[model samples]
Target: MIYLDNAATSFPKPPEVLEAVSAALSAPASPGRSGHAASLAAARSIHRARKNLARLFGLPDNSRLVFTANITWGLNTALEGLGLQPGDHVISSAMEHNAVARPLNRLAAERGLVWETAPADGHGFSSPDDFKKLLRPETRLVVLNHASNVSGSLAPAREIKAAVGEIPMLLDAAQTAGALDLSDAGDWLDMLAFTGHKGLLGPTGTGGLWVRPGLALRPLAVGGTGSASESIRSPDFLPDALEPGTANTHGLAGLAAGVEALLKKGVDQIRAQEMKLTGIFLDGLSQIPGLTVWGPRDTNSRVATVSVTLKGYSSSELSAALEREAGVLTRAGLHCAPLAHRHLGSFQGGGSTRFSLGPYNREEDLNSALSALDRLARLKA
Candidate 1:
């Protein structure tokens, strides 16, 4: 099948990534657990992955990087470990996924911390000006997604940084990590939550959070960190403070290879290819009657993800038809950001059908998808 649901997880990872993971799993010992050769090797692999991530994100200190199961866990580590107390305010955008919104909402409801959502424009893009106007003096943290998972709308990170003026911004890079330029964001962002399976082309359950220096967060879990064995509490350090148990060394090994492949291929080239494919799909979809494409009409302001709805059918129907009848796989429903759907007016009925492109997508795949969509539209009409 032609997979267009890359926003969930990328398929067809590089062969090297698979090899790395298999080799790591075949190794004898776990990383950071023992002083044996196998353990040392595993530790070295993990260290290499950390360094690669730091280099990719333009982080000065590799030690500040901590691995998590995925972007959700990374965001959890950043939000929960920050020790947000009662009465403190947190600001976020209306375009946030459940990963960011659910936890914050729970915190606000239980702890009495004030939660404010910055309004976005009609296209689900938030303005830095509107974000600035909503900031209260008690606002302790600002969490925003780098790009909308539903609409692929890009956020104004620099402008938001300038507006907040050092109020600890945590940028969720789940949708933009390997697809867009993110090295410059590290300088302005206090923490960044990233996933490995999407644009990074790594195996599932691999992700991390890069923390800036001079920021201390409480530990989410306290256990044996291969350090402070004599003490009962977790080690008060950058990685160990957050990474509680044994690390995902196998996943990280594969992640390192994936990251290396991305660097080798060049992000700009990959982005250009994705953009070309998305443009082709967009143009083709626009020609079909009863198809309404969402997000920025111009390709410059969005990622390769596009959401659409048919005039007479639900998104699920279109997605199923594409998958079953046309051999094209696409995602249907809210795409995990229901507020984003509400903003786009897609929540009242069914959510938009999303087609997210990856680096490996080719012109032929675009043509096939477009042809399938055209046939589906004709049938509906």
Candidate 2:
């Protein structure tokens, strides 16, 4: 089967990731719970994963990195942790996923906060200037999705952060974490939430958030952090303040190995490979009649994900046909980013089919996808 759903979750995880997970489970271990040999080994494994991710994101302080269930948990923590009072303003973009939108909307309804959406062009690219125009005296924070899951269009995150000045910027790097070069994140990003199952090439149940120094987020839940058992209040340290209860030691073990492999191979090399595949796929897509491609036509402005709508076919119908005829798997519908679909004029048609390429995908996979789409388009005609 040709898998093209890397944006949702990567497939065929690295062998090292599988091995690391197995090794962690092979021994009875509970991270930070006991000083026993197995427990210490688990704690060390978690620390190594945190340190590797910190280095990957250019964060000097690995202690500030807190592991969570996924990016949604991190985003919620960042949004709720900010001390936004009534009448405060928050700025997001027209291309954000529900992760950002839902939290902002809830805050608006419950806390009397004002939420504003920065405008984006038809291609779903948000400009820094647009963000600057939305700033208000009460604006407390600026949140943005680094890349649109539906269109695969990238936001000018650094430029937007620079435009907003001191307003804390939260980045949802769900799509770009392991696929893009984020080594300079510390230079511009204030807070970043990432998932491991996607680009990180790690197992599910592994993700993290990195908070900049001096930026403290209120813990969403308080419990035994395994550090401050003497007092009732949770530990005020970096990760201990945020992460509570038993840690996901087994998942972190795999995550560490995944980041290690990424570091060794280099993010730049992986990006180059995906770019080459995207260009070839785009070229093939352009030749198909009745197929309207979405997002930035330039491969440089987007990730490897490509979205398209074929005439006479709903997103679901097209995806079903692809899988049935050619065993090509693709994700259809809004991709949990309704705002993005509305911004790109695809919401009325029930979203578009997304073809997300990964490092493991080959030239022949793209060729198979293109050929299947071409046949489907011809049949519809």
Candidate 3:
């Protein structure tokens, strides 16, 4: 199958990543557990991985980056650990995934913490100016999506920071972490969440959150940090403060190798190639009749993900037909982003067929998909 479902999880791991994981599993030990050779080796791997992540995102302090099971857990840790009082408000974009929306909604329902969203345009873009109007003194945090998972439109994080001046922001860098350059994120963001499975080219069950200096969050879970074991409460430091139980050192080993390779290859180079491919695909898509391509029409404002709706078919049917007839793999349905779909006018059509590009995709893959879409669009009802 021509794998185009990379937004969910990248397939065919890099050789270095695979090698590192294999090496760890072969001679494994719990990280931060003991002083033996195996334990020390695990600790070394996790430490290196944290440093690599810090370098990737321009983080000054590597220890501030804490690992979680996935981006959801990282987000929850950030949200729940904030210890917000009643009537505290959060400002987020309409393009956010349920990862942010669900937790905030639950907070509203349970804690009386109301939240508001910055609306997006038809192209899936939420302007920083529009975001500015929604800001209030009661706003405890500003949540930003670095890029949309559906239309792939990029958010103006730094611009929003200018509008938000001094208010803490949490960036959801799920789609842009390893796919794009963010060397200056540390300058603006107080905290952010990232997943290794998508753009980072690492294994599932690997992701983390990064907190800037001078920010202290109440520990969501407080027990067994390996350090300060003598004390009843969790340590007042990072990594150990947020992380509980045994670490996923084997996955972290893969993540370290993945980010290292990404660094060597260069983020700009990957982005340039993806934009060229997206241009080619978008040009071809424009020729097809009865098809609506959503998101920014130009490459300047988006990633490689493209969402499309056919005139006479549901997204599920089109995806099923494409897979059966063309051997292409694409994601269909709501993509766990129902509010985003509603904003983009795709919710009524049962979501959309999403074609998310990865570094491994080539020109021929897009051509093949476009040809298949052209043929499929012409079929009789």
TM-score leader? 2
lDDT of 2 at 222: 87
Candidate 2 clashes between residue pairs 3 or more apart in a chain or in different chains: none
Model 2 misplaced regions, further than 4 Å: none
Model 2, range 1-381, lDDT digits (tens) per residue? 999999989987899999999999997988998889999999999999998998899988889889999899999999999878999999998889998899899999999999999988899887899999999899999999998898889888899999999999999999999999999898788999999889898999989799999898998998988896889988899889999889888898999999998898899999999999999999999999899988988988899999999998999999999999999999999999998999899999999999999989999999999999999999989
Q: Write the per-residue lDDT of candidate 3 for residues 1-381, one digit (tens) a residue.
A: 777787888766789999999998888588898989999999999998998888999888899999998998899888888987789988998898999989999998999997999877887688878878988889889898888889999998899988988888999999998888997788778998999888888889999899998878886677787898888877888879999888888899999998998888888988999899999999999998899887887898899899898888789888888899898999999999998998998898789999998888999999999999999888842
The alpha-carbon lDDT assigned to residue 272 of candidate 1 equals: 87
Q: lDDT for every model? A: 0.88, 0.92, 0.88
The candidate 3 region of ten consecutive residues with least summed lDDT is 217-226
Residue-level lDDT tens digits of model 1 in 1-381 = 898889999988999999999999999988998999999999998898888888788898889999999999999888998889999999998889999988998899888879988888888777888888988889899999888988888888778978998799999999999998787766788999999999998999999898898788787677878988889877888788888889998999999999989989888888888888888888888898898887887678889999999877799998988898878899999988987899888888779999999988888888888888888888868
Model 2 poorest ten-residue lDDT run: 118-127
Q: Top lDDT: which candidate number?
A: 2
RMSD of each: 1.1, 0.9, 1.1
Question: Over all chains combined, what TM-score does candidate 1 have?
Answer: 0.98
Candidate 2 local distance difference test against the native: 0.92
Better of 1 and 2 by TM-score: 2
Error of 1 at 363 (Å): 1.4
Clashes of each: 0, 0, 0
